[model samples]
Target: MFKINNLSVKFIILIILFASLIFGCTNNKINQIEDLRKNNNELNKTDTSSSPTKLTPKNTIIDLENTDSEERLLNNIFSSVAPSVVHINITKEMDVPSNQNIPDSFGFNFGIPDEPEQYFERGEGSGFVYDKEGHIVTNYHVVENAEVLEVSFIDGLTVKAKYIGGDPDSDLAVIKVLSDPSILYPVQLGNSDNTFIGQRAITIGNPFGQTWSLTAGVVSAVGRTMRSGNSAFSIPEMIQTDAAINPGNSGGPLLNSNGEVLGVNTMILSQSRSSSGVGFAVPVNIVKMVVPNIIANGTYIYPWLGVTLSNISLDIIDAMNLDLKQRGALIINVFDDSPAANSGLRDSQKNIEVSGGTITIGGDIVVSINETEVQTSDDVISYLVKYTQPKDTIVLKVLRDNTIIPIEVILDPRPGK
Candidate 1:
């Protein structure tokens, strides 16, 4: 017989397979990234023969025809975005040699040492004006552990910015420069809900230190959820695009055809560390959800269930003789002061003496919420999110032993006290 470790590995493989089946690709995209980049360097650049007049005519009345609507749209989009979009340069601390250091004018130390080299993790990305009061939006991972921030715009203006607020759960940050409101060109917000597949999208950013560049593509998709920089939490309702968002594209505006900002381009799913036709933008909806809280309180809040859960195994269900027909979140741990704790919901984690021996207890399976069926834990949470406030109450049907019990519980906002 094979070892138990082998059986565990097999079980793990099966779970991963199940997850993949549940979350498969929405569509099979045809990647022409290579073909597009093959001559992109030459594509943007055009050269004219030394003097066409010398070869042809003297000063022909070049009655340059009027620009088309597309050109006008592009020009307007770029003009509205050029002033607000800014470049970000970050310096993270790294250990280096202590002795090998050099000083600058006001005496900023940086260099290599004899024993170890003192290092600074310097990197660059971009951001855009998020508000009128000098506030800007960017990716959290871009300046996660940054020490200094330098922002630059297209008008040859650069300034040192201050880290105002950030949320790692959503992978967003808010920064601000010390400047007048008129100097900052705030981007006009667009309704992401208005964006549909095949609608145009434009992004302006400093990719690879190349500043104030614009690229366009159609809205590839909407409500695309993925696990990108936020490894712990799933960034939900993402906007997927084939818009060629690259390394420095993070925090750039994802604009609609009407020159309105829909989202801030954040993550790219690529095999070669570049835009591979699979790019994701944190939906402006999420930005709108988190930005106000971050600006006011320096933090963002999420809805929390205040309980811990673990996937129930088939073997455990069979051994416990629990009802197998019911499907929902199996409660594992409930906090002492949680909403569930005051709802008369019993946590099964109690040691009991049957007759002379012992009994182990924990959590019962939540089979349903209200009249709606809880197919999975996600369904339970999704239903709760539809509620406008936490004061609302929800009814849960739980299966314990061979009997079904109803439990009513009040909800509370996450990141709670």
Candidate 2:
């Protein structure tokens, strides 16, 4: 009986201990599950807060507003600049022989011709008000030989304008209208030297007689040269753009996004005599230089170098034994008693046949002028025409007999000044 009682007590003690252990383990697992649930909730909250919001109607509205702002900018530019634009019409008189043949019945016809008949030829172009003095700036070709000039504003106001002056070398001209200063809106000039390719370019002009037409594009290129119509000289440092400029658009202002004048629409490269997505403008910097001179003088005097120049090419290099890498303007013929001759510059001694044709030899090659590289004849011409004037002295780095020499020449007015 004693043994049985002891065993029963021991079994009871073991059951109590085992029950405590099982309950303790269940509580611990519950705590672990709770901690895991808390961590997962925090992670989900963070993900929800960090993810991008779905695009909604509000975002669409914002995009529309941005587009509207761009439209407003272009509209504002046009409104401010169109008033300064003008339509110019010119009439010229020409003499042509009369079509009437001498009647044989009148006399033994001394083959003398009949009196010439006078007729009026008309042309149209565009221009802009330049200043408060009612001065207008335009292309020289626009007002060339103009006997009568009629200037029309955007508001249907027309006035008779007189030719002030012009410079064909720059293809720029100025005219004056005797109008009230209150009616004239002068355009602001922008610094074209700061212009970059792909910047916004705007133009306002009369194209095909459509007055005050507006076009927009980006600057396609800078520092270009174009020859004036049938002229030996070329307009240099032109701004090329894809603006829709046509025949009558000549002389109109090319503006920047700020409505400031960046250039003057001059010409277009097209086979159909229309816009071919390639139009050129005389840079505003050149306009600034030439306009003031045109207003004071009747014509611009180009600085004369008095030498025919040829570009250094591979053929000339091989024929003259010149350095293959050297590029410059080759002096072909220095005129007598001219600035080049007075400066003791040497010209070509002879012409020799090369692979490319006849190449001139025995001439001093101009490598640099006034610290500017003279890589071609155009470079020398453009640099002198833009930066130097008559009586100005320029330093030329010349290459002679494989020796570099510096020559100083005092510029003179263009031949036949």
Top-lDDT structure, candidate number: 2
- Model 1, span 81-143: residue lDDT tens: 788899999988888544666788988987643454446889999888987889999988887
> Estimated TM-score per prediction?
0.64, 0.77
* lDDT against true structure, model 2: 0.89
Best by TM-score: 2
Q: Rate the local accuracy (lDDT) of all candidates.
A: 0.76, 0.89
**Cα distance off (Å), candidate 2, residue 238:** 1.3
- Stretches off by above 4 angstroms in model 1 are 1-68, 96-113, 116-118, 306-407, 411-417
The count of residue-pair clashes in candidate 1 stands at 12
Candidate 2, residues 10-123, lDDT tens digits: the string is 999999999999999999999999999999998777566578977688325333354677677877898799999999999998876554555587675544454547779999
The RMSD (Cα, Å) of candidate 1 is 27.2
TM accuracy, model 1: 0.64
